[model samples]
Target: MEHPLGVQPQMGLFEGGADVAAAMRTRGLGALACLPDEALLNIMHELAPADLARLACSSRALWAFANHDELWKGFCLDQLEGRWDFQGCWQDTYLLGKQAKGFQPGSRKMRRAAGLQSDLLYTPWLCATCAIDPSWLEVENVDRRSGLSVAEFREQYEIPNKPVILTDVVTKWPAMKKWSRPYLKKAFKGGMTPACLPNCVVRRFDKTFCETAPQLAKDYTVPEVFSDDLFKLLCEARPDWRWLIAGPYKSGSGWHKDPNSTSAWNGVVSGRKKWILYPPHITPPGVRPSCDGADVASPVSIMEWFMSFYEHKASTRCESVGYTPAECILKEGEIMFVPRNWWHIVLNLDECVAVTQNFVSEVTLPHVLSHLRSRSPALVSGCAKEARSGLYDRFVKALKEHRPELLERVAAEEAAKKKRAQEQHKLAGLFKGPEDACPGVNLANGSSAANGSSANGASKPEASGSAAAAQNGTSAGGGFSFGFKL
Candidate 1:
């Protein structure tokens, strides 16, 4: 006898599984059931998630095959619509989705320390750029008298990187007034001590600490702490804002550029914050001055130096070591926009309560997309493997067509800077001495020479003496003087 698909039949009744095969054949599923598991899986792979899901419901074997994680992973990649990677799509569906439970925030320390060697399973969060876009933030100068509406705000300051202070947005929320230092202390009890503060262990203010701390994570569960009406208003008004609350330390945030793909708005509800911004091309002045000697003499590189200083024992004392940051006291009902890729560090002035969001709007999309195209070609090109395929070819094409000059200029400047640094190091080795040993100090002092005055300009000689004493804790020579302001 012949099988339904016209192949010769096997001799035994149970060869094709009598009961199972007969039932499957009657239901027009004989071919699928008789096929090897691998062959069946290959056929199913061509189906979409929805179609595959429906097929899985047909039988227990089909269910098992469709439920295989490899299939799900492939399904996710296909569903990503070419905009995100498989891992990103999985994260969006399984981690960030509203239905997902016990979602954990990522740790910066684990990320930096592990680098690229970390297992993807252990570190599943998407990169900051993937998580949010800065261009969607809409800012409007809310008239203190006339009420601010969401539409008006979106229309005015929809550009990337410009954050506006919304005067009345959260004024009615009780948490706006209730969340404070005392409240945090009460909420966490003894756990609110300096030892438990965010980035307190490293003595740096890092968001990762807050995300990972057991106590803070538990405290974050306080349901309905924020008013439903307010939450709803924000959700309706700015559907794109990803609310973030950071707290309870004076640790300085790391200096980093906001991913150009996203814009952020931060509001400090209970305390003050100091923001230090450095232009994209320039390192923070303090960092620039200390780079070479600090990089050469210490095992820790210059990058690590700044990281360590900011991460150092969180004390108010070191606050005076550098330029005072621009101060802003964000109280209840105030908002501040942080534009894209602006390098900034934030100091939590008190037990701070704040909310922040990254957004994308129509006006900023062009700029944001352009930035993403330029900065993260690999991300757009899929991953390492696919990047070498058609993705890389597309990237090269785009570079040649749209940005050849810009790319060339960037390469040239990098080469020029490298050459200058090499020359400086050679010169330093030849003239190694106290005054000339560090060109940075000499340059700083020389600029201060014209003033011939103290930092406060109260008294030139006394100020000079104080500075000299502070430098090496000695005024050994009567002629010794320090000219620069602290």
Candidate 2:
């Protein structure tokens, strides 16, 4: 059709244009800029730190708005869990937080006290370490060839409290085939959802506040042996203990223990990782306890510090200390155990997708219980309160309902221990009596009736053997083993 104005619509053109214009009005800059400053900021509050950075670069107005300290302050409190003046620059503070998870220093002295060299610390020394000595660390690897059984796992790894990478454990999980960087990026909101990148070594995308990878809960399930997690039972209210960790190279956790002394298992669906573990007895060099003697803080990334130490081991002071660290190259379709209280560092070797859960099992129940009782009973999210006493009692009841035999066995063992302890106490006291010490001694008055008149008008005899020895000019020996005349 032709129009007099020479702007005639093509077939369905006017209708399509109306739809497109309406969509733009709802989604495009018109929609964004028309929003009030407060509403715009409220929308910006929903953005992740990385997205916020990108938004600032989008335009001058957004740059000014995103740079507001008030916005960053709220971000610090929400994302970082606390607020600190990073010299009145919330962006620096926010970026510092993204770099170092759980870093909030109120003062320079606080940073120093935390063993942090500076408020902002990141170094890429892992690549160098892998090049120089890839297998320098000493973590144990259990391949399919090892033929490890449940019994062997319990006795050697769980009971003895050690970490091991089991290659055959998760070979059948659907995630191994389905999860990939490209696939996930496409399926899960254009791969821009800032994952808990191990490169940053911080937990990312809290499901409590954000949605998750649609395929996570389906493709992966807890490994068979580790499915009986009591920590999860206690922390039934908290779903954050389990994490779907996905990130690019050089991203993983820092040198830290799993919260509340819970043991954990990590299964790699795809990609490889460098896992380093330190036993509870040996504190990794440069790891220091905070002021409370409870929490620990690190100055440098664990990998960097350990790498420097490994490179300088020949003439360095660490040679005198002589600590062996456990390291492993965890590959795809493999699972690893991180024992309770073990300090560990995980660095992704490549684009990685993994699942991990902090757990307490029958083996670690007692330790987890002890950890819980030591902390404040008020249930705060993510702290090991799930391992506490009152919560553990509830867990025990639940276990009794589902797995009564297991509870019965534990009860029987505890009863037997108590019986043995009581028997030992009686046996220890059996030989102790008044006659065993001083014969015929009076309790009411400190008088030996052996050589004095008793209350009943009877005289007890003194030691005649000693009296005879003295009369025979042989002094009764008391102090010295060798007889010497003084």
TM-score of each: 0.32, 0.54
Candidate 1, position 109, lDDT: 16
- lDDT score, candidate 2, position 224: 65
RMSD of each: 23.0, 22.6
Write down the lDDT of every candidate, Cα atoms only: 0.40, 0.55
Give the per-residue lDDT digits (tens) of candidate 1, residues 1-486. 211112222224645445544554335444565665557668877887668767766754354455444565554334432232123233334223233355443411111111111111111122211221122112223223225454544443332123345555555556565555455445445443333323221122224334343343333222121111111222222223344355444433555544433456665556555554432222343343232111212212222323344343122222123332222344545666565444456655455656555544333333334443443333232234434234324433554575565446544554676677678767645644466432332344442233344344433443334334334433111111121111
Model 2, 1-486: lDDT tens digits are 221111212224354454543343244334485665457767877787678867766643455445555566667767765323244356667767676554554432210111111111113222222443455534454323245776777766776566777777688787777765555655565444434433332335334212455555677777666766765544355325777777656556777777665788888887788876655544566567553335667644545655655443232122124545666888888888887777677777777777888777777655554455444444223635444435545656666777677566566665776677678656645544565455544555644433365555564323233234333534321111112111
Q: Which predicted model would earn the best TM-score? A: 2
The local distance difference test score of model 1 is 0.40
> How many backbone collisions does model 1 have?
10
